[model samples]
Target: MKKILYAIIPILAFSIIFLNMFFGHLVFESETQEVINKYSVYVHLLSEWQSESKNIIFDVTNTWYKSDKIRNTNHVFDAESKEYNSNQLHEINGKSYVELKHEFSDCQEEWQPMLYRKAVDTVRHEIEYVQGQQLSTDPSVSVYPDTENENYDNSEQQSKIKNGFVQFFPICTSKDTTSYNFSVKTDNKDLGFDVYFVSSSDQRENFVNSKFDYYTESGCYGQNKQSYSGTCHDIKKDSGLLVIFPDDLKPWTTKVTVNLYENN
Candidate 1:
């Protein structure tokens, strides 16, 4: 009887732990996001970027990404409010480009205008930020409404808050260019059913699959299981660096330092 009891204890523990881990990934399946603005930054080639002479300017003033739960039938929890606002700087042959700069701010505050310089040198290879020309004047830009309580609940219904860290988990990390399709078909359990790839051409494809690691100055946040903590992630390869956020922590107004790298 004692041996049977001991066996049952292990089984119960496994079940409970597995259930929690599984629950961490649960909210993603039912999530439906409306990407107001998204673009790809090609990081593999450095030589091509250095030779660029065109002066790239902002196309749109503000771009954001937000996700909502389609399964919220009662409309209890407010729409998942997560966004990163940045200017779109395009790379054209006639343009003179310099630094790839980034700034972090939340929804309520007046974000500072990010400054860019033409003189730059770096340790890594190279990267170019593709942006839309209509950023400031674009009529499609939508404002994300605030919620009554910004605090998230800790319950079984809560899943991992990716914190805008979504990566292509398939073959994109292995090569310079990888083409895969995400279908919104409910029957396919491997690929998610919430977000579907709508762009048919690779040039217009806003979704980029790369791995990254993030950290804050105060050590408030660091690398997750899915991210690479080394000098470089999936630089020239396809979906190599899979960045993941903390499962236990909910969204609070916090800032993080994002690093970009390329190979020599």
Candidate 2:
């Protein structure tokens, strides 16, 4: 009877050890799979973020290029002649300036004359001073405004008010990256501008109406800037509007570059 009991006790011990080993293996496999699933989700999200960022950059840059081309081809002022070439002043948006002036004359708005005179004078003066010397015939010579000067005249700046030199752009921020960067530069050093990033169209409209009075407590903005570079991280949404407003009534072209990083 004692020998039989000893054999049974050993068999029971062995069985218990075997069961523990099998259960341990199952637990290990489950934990490993969980880790792999998490990793795969991260990789997928990263890929999507990269694709979206590339598309946003391409769209913004393309739009900027088209705008520059249109402005260059359509608007050319001869300061010396003090005239807009009538041939080049073809109907824009299906309405000619000649037609608009005739309509304004008929309406007899009290502000029409002053407004027209200011517009014409501003165009003439800006073109003369901003262009500097006559454009060269050489292909290498650029006709764009020069931005090398680091100093601006305070008197001239004070005399000018912010104008309608505004541009709107769409910006996309990636949740995976959590932030993005931008750089803005103008060819006219005298033409300082403001940059605002807003999460909604309503915010953009508010900014336009308030102009310099508008303020953002949780967004990115650069005010009275000729050239600026910065990063935005407090993004409340995945997409937003980038609004640019010139500080003065000057016709200038600006170049903007946006960047996104995987590790940011």
Regions of candidate 2 where Cα sits further than 4 Å from its true position = 1-162, 174-177, 211-219, 238-241, 247-264
lDDT of 1 by residue, 1-264 (tens): 999999999999887666544442232232333211112222111234331221211111222223231343333422232223233333322322232323223221122121111112111112211122111231222111111112333231124322222222222222353322111111111111112122122211232322322211221122222111223222233222222222222222112212222221
Query: Model 2: per-residue lDDT, tens digit, 31-53?
Result: 11111100000001122121221
Off by over 4 Å in 1: 1-228, 232-237
Model 1's alpha-carbon lDDT is 0.25
Q: Which ten residues in a row have the lowest lDDT in candidate 1?
A: 184-193
lDDT value, residue 197 of candidate 2: 57
Residue 142, model 1: lDDT of 17
TM-scores for all candidates: the values are 0.20, 0.34
Give the distance in Å from residue 217's predicted Cα in candidate 2 to where it truly belongs: 6.3
Which residue pairs in candidate 2 have backbone atoms (N, alpha carbon, C) closer than 3 angstroms, thus clashing? Answer: none
